[model samples]
Target: MSDSIFSIPIIAGTFLLAGVVKGVIGLGLPTVAMGLLGLVMPPVQAAALLLVPSLVTNLWQLLAGPRFGALLRRLRGMMLGIALGTVAGSGLIAGPATGAATTALGLALAAYAVVGLFGPALRVPPRAEPWAGPVLGAVTGVVTGATGVFVIPAVPYLAALGLARDDLVQALGLSFTVSTLALAAGLFWHDALPLQAAGASLLALVPALAGMALGGWLRARVRPGTFRLCFFLGLLALGGELAWRGLG
Candidate 1:
């Protein structure tokens, strides 16, 4: 979408809010930002606008800590899944299949939010199989590339792996960074990435970075259960809105 007078403030406010949430939670910038932006911009444009900021923030997250090598080794399979799924999803976005994918994304996000809120109590048996990470990562990659939804399928797998909270957050951040860059490239190849979209995405980096910082700080002080509750609720609301828009 072009930067019209009406869209400027909307874009700024969306990023600001998205930044704050990401700053507190270590993720959700794209989910929250794209959700809001979808109200004002086309779904594809909203997803595109989040590309630059998401890429930058994820790069920082991936590189920010000690034990990077160990973490990478542990999550390597998932990363591979992310790569495969991202390519598949991005290819789908180029055809007439986008609408069905978008609608499914909206519903998936909604289901994720609901399950995240209530299903943690019902733990699935943890799998020791090597294929788990790849499966989860691939699913996350597809959802992310197609609709900017990153938390589904992957979050449960991450949790199941018993990763330290910090590790989980960092891994997710890195995964998103890689997947978003790939998706953006795919969009560009398909002539979907315009200069205006790139500019807006770059501008959004400011708030996204700020929010990531804030979220990292907050993660320590907040109760994990409470934070999850609130975050999932936010997701639910966003997902519901998306579904409504799609159906309408």
Candidate 2:
């Protein structure tokens, strides 16, 4: 890891911004964090710093929801697929192909941003979820392993499941939580998660929590739709630059 790129102020600030995004939108912590941090560090190192804050915050969201048990039973197969897919790509972090990982991360973010900006409010019939859930989860897990970003199809798929607003938020939390844990296991498997990175991630939690609180407060004052649009545009630009740099 580059000493300059992996500094305290940078990590703290990146996570703070990510938390704000997640707090306002109910998702985007990993996506935003990876997009920003990926500019300065390798994907695997960025992922190492991502684990703690992402896990803790999303875990709270998971347990705070109203329909925890029911959602679990409903989404079990998807969870299994996430774990399996993550295992399949575990060695990615331990490798030296920084360009490959950066390109993957950039493409994922750009695609996700495009979807958020223009994707329809799709609805998945109840009958389709049994199979659709696992397939999407596997794909999300593969993306997570490759880039440390967890949203891709998971968010859209969950939105399509016809969940109410609260359920959607909770489901995002649940899926992100599962993704975080699975990624952590993969990193640990390849010794990518060292003590220093763990400490930095933990240190970042304070700013993340504070930013979440700020975002929650802002939700009432600012127009959410506008904020969301700007956020997506920012991601699209950032992702494009990253991809261009990596490709070059």
Candidate 3:
């Protein structure tokens, strides 16, 4: 949506809400904002609007944790895969094939929701890391490049690493930060992200941060598992709608 007095408030409110969700659960800002905003605007525009806030917040989340070096060392392969895969898939945003892209994005989201809700959590043995890391990361990157959402095999893969809770949060942050940067580069190459939209995306960060602060305070008191359930359910519904939009 174009910047206007009315649209600006809506944009801010969407980011505020998405930020609160991210603050509580350590993810979902882009998923929530892009999914909801897509109803009124182009999904690519929604994805573009998410760029600055996504980068700033995710970087903040990554740096706030203690395992930056170790996580980097551990996930190096995956990170490399994400960067390359995102670039490879960048043409989807620039091409005229958006209908197919959105369909794939919807299916991916629905699959992610199913995995989160009912699937067993699997553990990856240390020995498998060499091969598994790049594969999962590349898949996650492809999904992010196509859909503007980054959680998929990546989240489950990271969780499988059996990190401590804080480490998992930081890992998500690290992955998301990489995904955000990669997505930005992809969009720029595709010419989908204009300079004016970038400026507005930067401005959207204020409300996002504010909502994050509020959510962080509430996180101490809320049951995250409950919120997680709601989050997935919401995603499932949104995914269904998006899929329908694409198929219809």
Candidate 4:
């Protein structure tokens, strides 16, 4: 990675864009940052940059809600799955092979976009929660470890659980927070995240927070569905490009 890409302007701009998406939709920061930064740096670096902002933002979101304990208990299966799966696959991502990590990230992004755009609505019955949660969590964990993206089946699965709007948002925050921590641990275990990268990630949080403030302001003025459409469309293009680079 070029040292120039870590310049304040570039890093702030990248995180600002990511933060806005996250503020507006309550997700997408990591996705946007990974896609854009990957153009200049390795996937591991991109993922490393995402750590602090993702953790801080999601923690705030999680604490704002009233159902933390309940949600934690309820999602225990999925949570455990995510932890184990992430541990299992994190090495693949933080490993020396940038090509493999990039390919995986690209595929994960594309898969997420396709599912967001065209996948069927998922519905899990109350009786099925026990088995379904862990399975989805495990998949999301592996994806997070391998690609540094942790939405996929996890978000959709949470949505399918039939929670109210506020609860769902809180739940998403909890999930992201946990996922970020797991990824951090995984990277550390592999010695992929050095002190400098961690420092950069922490510094990047400022712009991300700023962007989120702006996004929050826009949330009421702009239509979420419309912004979501634009977001996914952007992801589609970015993902395609990354996939091509990885494949090449």
Give the best candidate by lDDT.
4
For residues 1-248, write the lDDT of model 4, one tens digit per residue. Answer: 34784566888899999999989999888888888888788888888889999999899999999999999999988999998888788998888888878887888788878877887877789999999999989999999998999887798899899999999999999888889999999999998888888899999999999999999999999999999888888898888888889888
lDDT, candidate 3, 1-248, per-residue tens: 47566778889899999999988988888888877776566667878899999999999999999989999999999999888888777677556776776776677778878888887979999999989999999988888888788888898899999999999999999999999999999999888888888988999999999989988988999999998898889888988888788777
Model 1: clashing residue pairs? 19-211, 23-211, 23-214, 23-215, 24-215
Candidate achieving higher lDDT, 1 or 3: 3
Q: What would the per-residue lDDT of candidate 1 be over residues 1-248, giving only the tens digit for each residue?
A: 86488887788778877777777767777777867776666667887888888888778877886667887887888888887787677755544554555565577678788877776643334465367778878888888667766677776666666667788777777677777877787677767778888988898787777766666777789886788788889778878877776776
lDDT of 4: 0.89
lDDT score, candidate 4, position 210: 98
Candidate 2 lDDT over 85-186, as tens digits, reads 876676765578889889888999999999999998899998988899899899988888888888888888988888988888888888898889989999
Relative to the true structure, candidate 2 reaches a TM of 0.97
Misplaced by over 4 Å in model 3 are 1-6
Between prediction 3 and prediction 4, the one with superior TM-score is: 4
In model 1, which runs have C-alpha deviations exceeding 4 angstroms? 94-102, 121-129, 213-227
Query: Candidate 2: where is the Cα deviation over 4 Å?
Result: none
Prediction 3 TM-score vs. true: 0.95
Every model's TM-score: 0.87, 0.97, 0.95, 0.97
The predictions' CA RMSDs to the true structure, in order, are 2.6, 1.2, 1.5, 1.2
- Cα shift from native, residue 197, model 2 (Å): 0.7
